[model samples]
Target: MGANATTLHPNVASGGAYDHMKLNNGIKYSFTYELRPGSGSSWGFELPENQIAPTIEETFASLWKFAEEIYADDNATGRK
Candidate 1:
């Protein structure tokens, strides 16, 4: 799916580089996520056309979950 279009690829729906496989069930999804050498941090999420927009709580919870995943990954290194 194009960035300008409403339909989203599973990668975009999930968080691009941080894709968590949150795609709709029963459908196979695959994407290769790589951060280019000069790229800065970026994030994204997919709100399916059938699902309502996330509530403030849902958004925050998802954010925290993503943060935790990063914190847990051995490859993620930075100031503690």
Candidate 2:
């Protein structure tokens, strides 16, 4: 994927779904991903058709890695 990444804290007062799930519903893990056009493209949310496959592939890879790491940690800690 090799994409630049950053973490954002949503405004609690905004009461977005992620905030509600994490703050009110006792869900410890939640994320919001904004998959925008690559690098210098000004397309914003409108990803071009040509980039769709690559974007999906990159996102899938990232998710897979995240799951693998979480599973490994759970195993190491003996958490079911």
Candidate 3:
């Protein structure tokens, strides 16, 4: 990812797991989500590099799933 694309959060400004795809509108996009340090429900996604960014609805859906999985894993491991 480029500097601009990777500059999502001041702290989470770099590497993470990426999910990429081309939307029906022909716009290619990817988002990277990484957990913040310590014990809390905090995460962030990188900015899409395409001309058209994903909509708020799309972003929310993706983030909700990502957070749900993390929460599940944490609960499974008794890491809360």
* Cα RMSD (angstroms) for every candidate in the order listed: 14.9, 5.5, 16.3
On TM-score, the leading prediction is 2
Per-residue lDDT tens digits for candidate 1, residues 1-80, read: 22212234444453442233435342223334222222343422333444334344565676687677767763465535
User: Any idea what lDDT model 3 has?
Assistant: 0.49
TM-score against native, each model: 0.30, 0.64, 0.36
Query: Number of the top candidate by lDDT?
Result: 2
Runs of candidate 3 with Cα error greater than 4 angstroms are 1-54
Lowest summed-lDDT stretch of 10 residues in model 2?
A: 1-10
For candidate 3, write residues 1-80 as lDDT tens digits: 43323465546544333422232233333445432332342422333444124455566787898788878877888976
Cα deviation at 70, candidate 3, in Å, is: 0.5
Angstrom error of the Cα, residue 2, model 3: value is 16
Ranking the candidates on TM-score from highest down gives: 2, 3, 1
Give Cα-based local distance difference scores for all models.
0.41, 0.67, 0.49
Clashing pairs in 3: none
